[model samples]
Target: SQQGEEDPQALSIQEGENATMNCSYKTSINNLQWYRQNSGRGLVHLILIRSNEREKHSGRLRVTLDTSKKSSSLLITASRAADTASYFCATDGLNNNAGNMLTFGGGTRLMVKP
Candidate 1:
């Protein structure tokens, strides 16, 4: 079963604006990873935040995880047309029974208008 699910299935923003997306998951996780996929392309690794970590950042991307609420949010600052893509959240179960397996969410499609 899928562990993570992203909200606001779609988002639209203008270039230079900030875009935010949220994800919620069930069960405990070892780590959560965010990924970006352009239309007709492979998924690009974004950032990963461990269960002990509350927040993480990489370049223009900011991610916050709240295990208490079983939710996480990703913020993209200074958005550009190139930032337009589908964002997904993947989580690895704490049990580790599946080894390195990860469950992915449906993802949110973002459109950045120039």
Candidate 2:
């Protein structure tokens, strides 16, 4: 399957804590990206790490990729109420006919407590 799947569909954490989510896929990809969607807003790109890369960091966000295992993970440090949102992992499939397009996973809903 080309779809990515995430674990722990939901997570709750106190403010200032950290939250982590895992994703797995069943196909070869050129890259993987992490995105965040606020309550009613569209998805916002968080980070994109190529298949050759094993780890990447952006501000308070950290992403790790294990291509051999077809899995990736996202970690958000210093959680806040504003950080409450749905997180999704998208993969860039390797296709000759189709250019790069993001394929999103189910997603993980994060809730930050005050």
Candidate 3:
């Protein structure tokens, strides 16, 4: 089954500020990943947290997963105008895990002003 819902469809912040997004999924997920998209172009993977992982961080990016709540969150710090883009959360689970079918969240649009 398909699952994953992102909160706050849109957000606006200053260049030096920070942006945070949340995601919720319905099924049992093996892992959760965060991606960033510039304009309307392709997406770039930011971070991935396994179901067993509670939190992970990469540079300015931080991700947290709570299987108990079937939810996850992504945080981007020290934002820049170049960071303006859309973010998405993807879940890998069941018959649709990894190389199989991929389910993604609705996505959150972030606008960072210089």
Top candidate when judged by lDDT against the true structure: 1
Which segments of candidate 1 are over 4 A away from where they belong?
A: none
TM-scores of the candidates in the order shown: 0.96, 0.94, 0.92
Candidate 3 segments exceeding 4 Å error: 95-99
Candidate 2: what lDDT? 0.91
Model 2 ranges off by over 4 Å: none
Candidate 1 on 5-24: residue-level lDDT in tens? 99889999999999999999
Model 3 alpha-carbon miss at residue 48, Å: 0.8
Query: lDDT score, residue 112, model 2?
Result: 96
lDDT of 1 at 53: 98
RMSD to native, candidate 2: 1.3
Model 1 clash pairs? none
| Better model by lDDT: candidate 1 vs candidate 3 | 1
Q: Residue by residue across 21-107, what tens digits does model 3's lDDT show?
A: 999999887899888889859999888899899999999998999999999999889999988899999998865534645689889
